[model samples]
Target: MSSQRYELVFSEGPGTGEDTVVVAPTGLAGPGGHPVYEDATGIVRAEISDRGEVRVLATGGGQNAVRVVRVRPLP
Candidate 1:
């Protein structure tokens, strides 16, 4: 398993303006062949494309925003 991590930034969603969530690779791929990531609670699942396109598959309890403005790699 890779130790790669990512920061998912959400805009105009549940929390305050531009909420950022940290996610790690799930070692699984989505239907579009993109890597899937989930929050610590395993509720928010998203498939982020190479070009920084985020497709949210599942939101823990509808707490995630549909629009993810930015995705950045973590050091």
Candidate 2:
């Protein structure tokens, strides 16, 4: 499996530090190249796209807000 870091940016939505990023089960990958479904980050969730692009989802406080996912290249 492989590992990668992704930057979860809140483009449009509630103020900063208002929303939560939760881990969803979009059949994406994670730090390792494994089947990712969900995580225990409360409302803060994240997932990996098929192309290995990390897509984080914000929920709870900022669940209805828009999120910007940035995939960090392997170092």
Compared with the true structure, all predictions reach lDDT values of: 0.78, 0.47
Off by over 4 Å in 1: 1-3, 13-16, 59-65
Worst 10 residues of 2 by lDDT: 1-10
Q: Estimate the TM-score of every prediction.
A: 0.76, 0.36
| Alpha-carbon lDDT of model 1 | 0.78
Candidate 1 per-residue lDDT, tens place, 1-75, comes to 233788888787666588789988898888889999888988778887777777877654546445887888887
Best by TM-score: 1
Per-residue C-alpha lDDT of model 2 across residues 10-34, encoded as one tens digit per residue:
4464555533233335455456565
Instruction: Tell me how far the alpha carbon of residue 16 in candidate 2 is from the true structure, in angstroms, after superposition.
Output: 10
Model 1 scores a TM of 0.76
Error in Å for residue 21 of model 2:
7.6
Error of 1 at 3 (Å): 8.0
